[model samples]
Target: MTDHATTFRRLHQEGLLLLANAWDAGSARLIESVGAKAIATTSAGLAWSNGYADGDTLPVERLYAAVESIARAIRVPLTVDAESGYSDDPAAVGATIARLGALGAVGINLEDGDGTPEALCAKLDAIKRACAQAGVDLFVNVRTDIYLRGLAPEGERVGATLARARLYRDAGADGLFVPGITQRTDIADVVAGTSLPVNVLAYPGLPAAAELAQLGVRRLSAGSGLSQTLFARAAELARGFFRDGDSAPLSAGAMPYPEINALFAQR
Candidate 1:
C-alpha cells in the first residue's frame, strides 16, 4: 500500500497523467491491462452501474463495496471519485475517506460542487486528521466546480478557480481538479497560480495531451465520457434486439468471452 501510495503521488510530479476512469472491477482490471499507471473511479459511472443516479445520492456503504471490489481486481493504485464525500458533515466525510483508504484506495477526488470553499476546506482538514489517525496516506485531489457549474463569469472563471485552489491547497490538498476548463490560457493561468498539480477534465474544446503538458497541466481525466458512450451503445443494442431479434449487432466489437473471463479467472 505504501508503494502504491508513493507511486500514485509521483505520477503527478511531471508530465500529463491520463486517467481513464473506471466504474467496476472488470472495467478497472481491463484498464490496468491496457497499461494505465493508475485507476480512478468515475462517480457517475459507478452510481449508474449500481442502479443509482449520479451526484451525492449513492449510499456510502455501496461505494465502499465497489471500491473494495475494484481494489482487489487491479494491482495498480486506485483512486475514488467520492462526490462531496457523500455527506455534509466534515467528520462523516472524513471517516468515509478513511474507510476507502483502508480498502486500498491510495487517492480520492473530493469536489466542491454548489458548495462554499470554506466547507470544502473543513472537509479536507477533517480528512487529513482522519487519515493520519488511521495511518493512511491519501492523495486528496480537491475539485472545484467553478468552471463545471459556471460559478463565475467568463473572464473571472480563472481567478475564481485559482482562489478556490489556494484555499484547498492550504487545507491539505495534494492536487487540484478543474473540470470543464478548456481554454489554453485559462488552463495555464490556473496551473501557474497554484502549487498543486492541476487536473482538467476531457471536454470538447480541450487541448491535445501534448499541448496540455506544455501548458503545465499535470493530469487529464475522462470523467464519465467512456461510461456514457457505453450506456448509449447498450441502449442502441437493446433497441435493435427488441425490434428484430438480431443477435449479430450484440456481438459487434464485443470482447471475446474467453478474454473477459480470463480477467476474473486470474483473480
Candidate 2:
C-alpha cells in the first residue's frame, strides 16, 4: 500500500478520525491548517458551490476538476465523496474511481442509496479491480442509507444496515459509513455487527467524540453540515450588510488576507 493509503487505513484502527468536509480548495487548505488528519469532500457542498444541486446532478468533469484542485491544494490524504459513483454501471464507476486515485485521492465514499445490495456489491468488486489496476490502495467506505433515506423502519434499520455491511465487506469495502445514526445503542450494535471500521456522520443528536470512541466508531464526518452552516452565516451577514450598510458584521471572525494568501503562497 502507498504511504497515503496506509496512513488513512491505519487511522481507522487507532483513534477517531475526525473529518471536516471541504467544498473547495480554499476551504480544504483552511481545514488542513487546523490539523485535520485528512481532507474529505462533501458532494452536496461541492455541488452547491458549483451552482448545481446534489443527487449526481453535477457534471462528471466538474467534479474531477474540484477534486484535482483540492488534491493539489493540500498535503494530507484526500477522500472524494463520489456519490453513487455517478453512474449505474459497475465498470464506469470503477473507471471513475481509478481516475480519482490517479488524481491523489486515497479514498472514496460510495453509497447504496436505493440500489439493491447485489448491485452495490458488483460496483464494489469493480472498484477493487480498478484500484488494483492503478496500484492504488483506495479505501472504499461503503455507505448504506437505511436510516438516512428512511429505507427501513426504526426497528429494522440496524438489521438492514448489518446485512448490507456484510455484502459490502465481502466485496472489498474498507469501512462502513452509516449516516443519520446518532443513538448510542444503534451505533454500538452496528459497530459490533461488522469487523470493518465504522464511520458515522456528525449530527445534532450525535454523542460526543469521547462517547463515540467508546462505542467503537473509527471515524466521524461532518458531511455537508460545515458548508450548510457557512452559507447560512454568509446569508445572514449579507442581510445585515444590506440592511444597515455596515462592514462590522462582515469583518468579524474573518481571516486576514495575508494569512489567507499565505496558504496558497506556501504551495
Candidate 3:
C-alpha cells in the first residue's frame, strides 16, 4: 500500500498525468493494460454501472465493494472518487475514506460540489486524522466546483478557485482539481495560482495534452465521458437489435471476447 501510495503521488510531480477514468474492475484492468500509470474511478460512471444515479446517492457499502473489486483487478495504484464523501459529517466522511484506504485505494478525489470551502476543509482535517489513526496513506485531491458549478461570477472564477485551493491545501490536500475551467488563460491562471498539482477535467474546449502540460497542468481526467459514450453506443445497439433483430451491429467494433476474458482469467 505504501509503495502504491508513493507511486500515485509521484505521478503528479511533473508532466500531465492522463487519466482515462474507469468505473469497474473490468474497465480498470483494461485501462491498466493500456499503460495507464494509475487508475482513477469516475463516480458517476461507477454509480450508473451499479444501477444508481450520480452524485452522493450511492450507498457507502456499495462504494466500498466497488473499490475493493477494482483494487483487486488492477496492479497499478487506484484512486476512487468519493463524491462529497457520501455524508455531511466530517467524521463519517473520514471513516469512509479510511475504509477505502484499507481496501487498497491509494488516493481519492473528494469534491466540494455545492458545499462551502470551510466544510471541505473540515472534512480534509478529519480525513487526515482518520487515516493517521488507521495507518493508511491517502492522496486527498481536493476538488473545488467553483468553475463546474458556476459558483463565481465571470472574470472572478480564477480568484475564487485559488482561494479555495489555498484553504484545501492548508487543510492537507495533495492536489487541486478544477473540473470545469476550460479557457487557456483560466487554466494557466489557476495553475500559476497554486503550488498543488492542478487537475482539469476533459471538456469540449479544453486544451490538448501537450498544451496543458505547457501551461503547467499536472493531471487530466476523462471523468464520465467514456462511460456516457459507451452508454449511448449500447442503447443504439440495443435499439437496432430490437427493431430488426440484426446481430451484426452488436459485434461491430466490439473487443474480442477472448481478449477480455484473458484479463479476468489472470486472477
Candidate 4:
C-alpha cells in the first residue's frame, strides 16, 4: 500500500503516468502484459461491460466487484473511478473508498463541481472523513469536469477551470483531474492554481505527450477513449464479417490453440 502511495504521488516528476483504463480482469491483465505503470478503472468501461449507463448506474456492489477482479489480475497500483462517490453523501463516499481499499484499490478519483458544485464539495468532504475513519491511505484524485462537460458561454473555460480546480483542492483532493483542458494556457493555469498534480485526458488533435509534460501534466489518463476506440474497431470488424458473409480475419491474429489451452495451464 505504501509502495502504491509513493508511486501515485511520484507522477508529478517529469515522468508520465501511462494510465490505461480497463473494464475487466482480462483487459487489466492485457494492459499489464504490455507494461503500464498503473491501471485506472473507467466507469464507462465498466458500465458497458455490465450493460448500463456510463454514469452512476452501476450499483456500488458491482463496481467494487469489478475493481476486485481487476486488482486480482494486475500487479500495478490500481486507481478506481468512483463515479460521484456512488452517492452525494460524504459518508457513503468514504465508505466506498474504504471498501475499495479492502479490494486493493490504492488510489481513487472523485469528481465534483459537475453541476451542483456544493454537492461535489460535500462528497469530497465525506471522502476525506471516510478515508480517515477507515484508516486507508487512498490517494483521492479529485476530478472536476467543468471544463469538459460544462464549458461557459463567455469563452471562460479558463475561468471555470481555475475556479473548480481550486474548489477541489481545498476540499482535500490529493490531485486535480481537469478533463477537456486542451489549451496550453488553460492547463498551465490549472497547474498554477493548485499544487496538486493535474491530470488531463487524451484527446484527438490535441497536444502531444511532450507538450503535456511541458505544461506540467504529470498524470495522463486515456479515459474512455481507449474503450471507445476498441468498440469502433470491433464494429468495423463485425461489419466486415457481415459483408464477407463467411470466414473473416478474427482468428488470423488470435492466440494459438496452445495459448488457448494455456489459460488453464498454470493455476
For candidate 4, write residues 127-195 as lDDT tens digits: 777777777778888787777786575377767767776777788778888777787877787777778
Estimated TM-score for each candidate? 0.99, 0.97, 0.99, 0.91
Query: Which residues of candidate 3, in runs, are more than 4 Å off?
Result: none
- Model 2 lDDT, full chain set: 0.93
Instruction: Output the lDDT of residue 80, model 1.
Output: 98
When summed lDDT is taken over every stretch of 10 residues in candidate 3, the lowest stretch is 258-267
Question: What's the true lDDT of residue 178 in model 3?
Answer: 94
lDDT by residue (9-64, candidate 2, tens digit) is 88889979999999999999999999999999999999999999999898889989
Name the runs in model 2 displaced over 4 angstroms.
Answer: none
Give the candidates in order of lDDT, highest first. 1, 3, 2, 4
Top candidate, metric lDDT: 1
- How many backbone overlaps does candidate 4 show? 1
What's the CA error at residue 138 for candidate 4, in Å? 1.1
The residue pairs found clashing in candidate 4 are 90-126
Each prediction's whole-model lDDT (CA): 0.95, 0.93, 0.95, 0.79
